[model samples]
Target: MWFFGFSTTNPRNYWIIGAIILVIILTLILKHLAIYLEYSHKHNQEDDESERYKGSSKIDCSKCCSGAIRTYALEELKSATRDFRIRIGVGATSVVYLAELGDGQFGAVKRVMEEKGGSKKMFLDEVSVLLRISHPNLVGLLGFCLDKGEQLLLLEYVPNKSLFDRMHTRHGQSSGTLSWSSRLSIALDIARALDYLHSVADPAVIHRDVKSSNILLVNDNHAKLADFGLCKLGHDIQSAQTPTTIKGSLGYVDTCYLNTGLVSPKSDVYSFGVLLLELITGLKSVQGSTTLAEWTEECRKNKNVEVMVGMLDSKLKGDVNVQQLHVLIDVANLALLENCHGRPDMNYIVDRISSCMEPDIQPELPV
Candidate 1:
């Protein structure tokens, strides 16, 4: 048979055919050897990693993890999420989908995108933190799946959306404005949750990212802190400050943590202060012209109580109690103090906010 002008009758054609066969044989052999080596290397790496994971004290109790937290198969999660069809939330590192689990309960499945900040270390860190901590105001971890190159976290579905969207609603439209009491309640709820994390937890956790967007709301407008990917365990309260890469949103990052690489609960306190500012003024922590912190400082410097009052979200329609506004402003100012140590702790914050909720007392704005 003749192929590409090469015929068996010609000696040169025979040589050419022989060379083509030799090249094909060599290519097949090399490809097979490479595949075998890659497989062997991957198997060894996975074995070593598995051994390390088994010995890790951070997630030591496999029984607890398996029993307390459900581990869904990759195929199951895919089916529940409809191939990630219904996206409820998105962030730099992950995409969250609203899923209907087989058990008939709804869940928010946060799928880690490989190209984003979804490093193996971060994924495990988040899972480790979520596995141990449980509080009413903190988002509950229902389950997780880390198989078949997929990293997903199944969380309690909070229906009312985030505090950010509620507090910073666009235009003049009102989707049931958060009453002053509701705002205070949300603030107190978050404060207690943070206090639990900072003091009550065994090793303690620092919620490195404590922005308003991370605060989710239930149907009743109750606040629940979500997103634990940036959480870090503090060795102890006194020596909580540890050197690490700066991780947090702008406008809310503690200046001390930014300037010095040390991360402590105080860093969270600073961010909480910004959150308080957002709740009180109904302005973003970072405004277009300046930060909420800077704006508040300016108002404080000018001693202009009217300017401060005027800054309250117009959506309230003059319904905000003066006493509550004053208390919120005071708390926010303390939280926004330049010195991290000067910021009030979460317990103190919760106390002040709770006291503000009292019906009888009404404090006038200070001169």
Candidate 2:
């Protein structure tokens, strides 16, 4: 019954093996402790930053913390919003009211409904995300209110409303028809916004909702991406994908994401592609049961320029430059590819859209 290896049979060998195992365990424990300490330190720093604004009504606006978020009292917000009576927009989990803040500037106040657990989580998530990001094409977060069991966000007021209202509302009901130049410019603005989120932000952001309805137009018709409730941070732009509950608009959600429950920046690209199609065709992303993407797939697949041209928005029929329209269609097709990995990045999309606009032609707003 003698073992071939002395270490397997000897008592001294057993002790040595036990010591080795203990050392390995200790090393792992120490390594994990260090990681935990590092994370705690980072979390504490964020907490300190947040504590600066907690229960405070005024923004610092100091050089060190410029554009810091403010905390508003429940009564203050109620007063600013005129008792939340002036409704400007409504959504599934929130209602937006136009407000006149203490500074006398107009703002949009979004009051989150407390009926669902997910809405509470979304309110916190939006605050976390908005605090870290800023861009010309991103809606600015002026402040927030978390008093008296209410979750409210005060944001910059974009007077011109959303791109969806501008593009899809029935004639005589819409603000006005968006000219081709305006559409091109708006597309470019949103592309730049996505480019900023995907490439420039420290940890790239994925605007999980990228439909026209989430795009607000400014006085000049430049687009600003809004609704950060579903946004996610991607640490690695190339391969980061988060498994999350499917939450996005019906017509704009990416099919791959919808099927797999895995979302990435490419999902945003797919939604943006659908938006481009909407801009070009003047049709809802979902009309009846048919998707705009599906409706245009045949012409896009066959490269039938004539068919694509004929599908242009009626209002834009005579105004669009054929060359620019072709460029937009090509970009949209690339973005809507079945394989998420094949879609072009936002930066590339920005460049392609820029090429469509001549340097000298200024974007004309709806009259």
Candidate 3:
């Protein structure tokens, strides 16, 4: 039958099938393109961010490290410490692992790894700055490590824990453990260190993160300031100002600095004020219901500032002259004034506090 051979060819059906296949292939291609574009965009964004961060960062290294401190490489630290085997202490800037000095040396080593801001800059800054300064009350820098992105600092091992440990060790236990003379001595030492940092150093150092925890208690009830990660020099201070990041611990941080980002020499003064309060009250600078400052002020205003005097450690009771106590507390209160400018300079403040002390209160005794 010669009937409709054209129809039997069925060109329309072939066309429909081809169109369907084409549509499927196009859909898969579009899906792949979208994924590739998304991934590429994300990767590009990451690269951009990395470049931006790298450009703004500054890293300046000094000649070795301070005699107070020394530098070691990551490999050297690993070899000396056997990979930080003995975990001793930790600070806001790094983890202090205990290690042997080796080489027939009996001294212990504190292995500190740069953990915040930028590790390399901090490593360089610490070594550079510490190398330039020497002080009796500051911890001695032993050595440091710089490798890849990891940096380690070796410091003289201090056996005693931070002031945080002493202050909060089972309530009155801390205060009772030491004599009034000892506590006062600690304050004096800290004040003296702060004074030196502000006045004597070529460029004044502002211990931005001063607190009891940063104060290391060593042999004979002595206290020394440690950790310079957040520290800045007066000239090197940020130009933009305006409340930078809140870098300090809560209770010990200067309230005025927090509010204004004005980290001057007096910044340490505010923190010392809190420390003084901590010593006087034998209570933590920070406690529940209110801050240490608030509680002290509340009691200070409502009743005689002497109401909380009973909280002093038994070892300190009456050991400190009440008249001297009054003077010290007044100094602390003024140092903690909400107005940063109202605070006294560290040098003047130290001299004043020192003047207020008895002849015996010099290096012979503190508090």
Candidate 4:
């Protein structure tokens, strides 16, 4: 075949080569287009979920009267929080900024960012899990907003501080007193929340990330779970793993979590165990010759769990009986069980911890 250009060899050969090259280019283009579409879809879903949350909470005379949170409009949130003018806090997936509404009320607007992978799933999980559940010991979700891939969760502001700030490391062995009752109370609250997540919720929600940083403390020495309710679940319990893009805090994450990339309510218990250890030993979990797992193992092997428990703050030292401290130890130890299934269910944990708190106090709910 000859054109005005140079003489072409065989038309069939040229046609075959051109067709193959065209197919290769098309394949590459299609692959890229697939990726772009996936990303766009995720972005759009995130946007939709964020928008589902709007409006602010109004005072309800009914209910417990603890001032239940009402959803807030996105615009009302912007006005109340001064367009997020006061930067209160930030986390890996979200930011907490102070806000106010037209009613002249103060609140917090938690701005959540959809993470790199499986973000749509994570965002939806948070909204679904948090909005329906409310407990005195759990942070309240005022509302949420999703727009153009930006996700925002409005939460009730707890101003005191985090349990992490009160790390026993701050002061010496005297690290002040997280009184036995207070510590026990904190434990019970967390346990109850975990129990609710593990047993009560529809498919169940796992607080994949639990650490002292995630425990919000109030003025009355009350504690509640924070940074929780965002988790990854799957087809079944056998494969309930959250998308991995860094979960939980350093030193607090369960060792097994690294292996399976799956987190369950038990994982939260493991972290709570670390918190208990911190409460008892007055030491940062990471500041040791061995991983907390190894250290705890050594303690068990040496039959010196008492030696560790003896490190508890002396403030209420005499107030709590030996049996009580030991029980707390057992509770923490049970949560640390290497096998997730072997660990006590959160309901059992709540019962045991609540019982330990006031050996005089019995479980109020059916387990």
Candidate 5:
């Protein structure tokens, strides 16, 4: 029907059409409202969790970017750690205590030093960054305690201590040297961790400090990267350079970062190369003024496999497979390349290291 026919159409038909259009519009509005409410609720829940742990109005959780992290009362943590009596480790910025929580879950509690604004910032940064990430090879943060000016971070307890302790003597106890294959596997674990931080993480992350002491071992002696107070975020892996104050362990710090005050995932690659040198030679990163990188470069000049193998730990003298030594040297070279662009990314390092570990016989697990 034409215009006149439409005007003459049934009033019931017009009413039905209007009602259908109204329903469609209302449906869309309700869907949008639901989405917004869900988002707000998630944020509100995170806020409530923060408030529950703060214990007082003076402690503002908004001061820090705490997203989905559980907060524990100071007394609860004290009880878990037996009044902080089980001191398992001591570091420059924090003290580590082995904690047994109420839920029967064992964890590590790191009591951060908040002696100054800088130290406080480090604690907040660690909490903020760690909350955003979760990877098997990366240490997991379970919760935190912000009470009495004490900032405590609760973490998954790694029973085997650190790779450094295993590689070197500590407390006059011979922890025994890591097998050649074990070393390769540990390196692979660390590489995979870095790969996740560098590429897989949304907005990415730079481990700023990559060293033997920061690499913890689980029950199976599998490695997990720890200590994220020094981590920095990046928009993407390729454009990850961020100008910041130079911060990292001495020997492992990238020369490029120091020279330019710029940090990136490549800086971590350089540190990983130094770590490889430590693993290959069983040497301290810095023996007096000489760094592992310098020593490795000097060894490279000789261009001799036996000379390189000579750098392997004396304990591993006859134990290391020749093929493994070659693999380590090749990866070390690529990672230690002077040009940042020349250094292979963590993904490449993981692949190369994985190949080296292929021939290894995995240690049997108990039933």
Candidate 6:
């Protein structure tokens, strides 16, 4: 009998076929083994890196702090915060309280809840990033506590609250509207912070979350980028586009990051663009199902200055510099481009915004 032109009953033919089959099987087994070994090596490397940053459950003050971060005992924080009773802000993973540190200094103490798996990771991640970075426009980490099952972070206190509180809250609205100049200044501050993170830092940092809520303001309306929980560090711009889970606030999240599950500095640029739209329109990033970015893009498609100006935050009407406003809108358009490659780097953005603040054009204060 013949099998595919080979004699099936012949001993020599059978031996030849068996040898070929065995060789093919061996090749496949070797290929699979190589793949498994590669994957195991990569995974172990990642775990080691994470372990280096994660450190022990209890941090050692002597080694961790080189005058950059202080290690606080739980009792010290509890006493400063009055047992965490003066709640100033609250989020999914933590609660912040107004604390009176000694010597009449004030600070914000963040208490990380022990309820979720990601909570501890977030705490560790924030600490790791904060330890390595320092910028005037970025929130400063004063100290941290990892004692008796409590995780607390002590941060510099900014009295004016967050940009979100100033823009969206009833109290903020009643107090006084943020002048167009203040808005522009706040935008610049945040842009500088992002620039520092993306360009100046030794290992570039991707904020991962950039929104009005994460922007804390000082009395002079200077903005500080906060919340480094979801940040990622990359040795260079190209390496920054690491694939990871999609995590960010709605509307402000980069569409590219959302679609691909890979994050880059451009993701922060996209979110900053959304923030620019928020500054222009005074609209929440999301209202019902419509996103501020989507809404602004739709309006911008009309190509009518009047139509676009009509969308400005009502309080900003008549006070806005039409020329500057146009410049800002144009910048926003570039930053919010659907293609991440088309987005301008933060340095370019800083220049464009600086152009709008030409020395002669003074900001109009709110009435």
The whole-model lDDT of each prediction reads 0.77, 0.79, 0.66, 0.64, 0.76, 0.80
- Model 6 reaches what TM-score against the true structure? 0.78
TM-score of each: 0.76, 0.78, 0.71, 0.68, 0.77, 0.78
Q: Write the per-residue lDDT of candidate 4 for residues 78-105, one digit (tens) a residue.
A: 6656566556556777777765432434
Please list all clashing residue pairs in model 5, or write none if there are none: none
Tens-place lDDT per residue, model 5, 1-367, is: 3232344266756766677779999999999999989977864564354233322122232312232458888987887776786666667778898776533346789998866333777888888889899888898887898898778998877777787766775421255667777777788888988999998998789989899889998743478899998888757646645567889998899887888887779999999998988888888899889778886686754568778777788877568877878878888888877778889999998877776666544332221
Off by over 4 Å in 1: 1-67, 102-104, 169-174, 240-242, 300-304, 359-367
- Tens digit of per-residue lDDT, candidate 1, span 75-137: 777776667766777887999976665333467889998899698888888999998898888
| lDDT: the better of candidates 3 and 4 | 3
Consecutive 10-residue window with the lowest summed lDDT within model 3? 52-61
Q: What are the per-residue Cα lDDT tens digits for candidate 6 across 55-148?
A: 1223333332344677898987887776775666677677787776544456788888878443677889889999889888898888998899
Better model by lDDT: candidate 2 vs candidate 6: 6
Lowest lDDT 10-residue stretch of candidate 2: 55-64
Candidate 6 overall Cα lDDT vs. reference?
0.80
Which window of 10 residues has the lowest lDDT sum in candidate 5? Answer: 54-63
Candidate 1 Cα RMSD (Å): 16.7
lDDT of 2 by residue, 79-133 (tens): 7676786676667678887776433346788999877443677899899889889
Query: What are the runs in model 2 whose C-alpha is more than 4 Å off?
Result: 1-66, 102-104, 116-118, 171-174, 240-242, 361-367
Displacement of the residue 90 alpha carbon in candidate 2, Å: 1.1
Q: By lDDT, who's the top model here?
A: 6
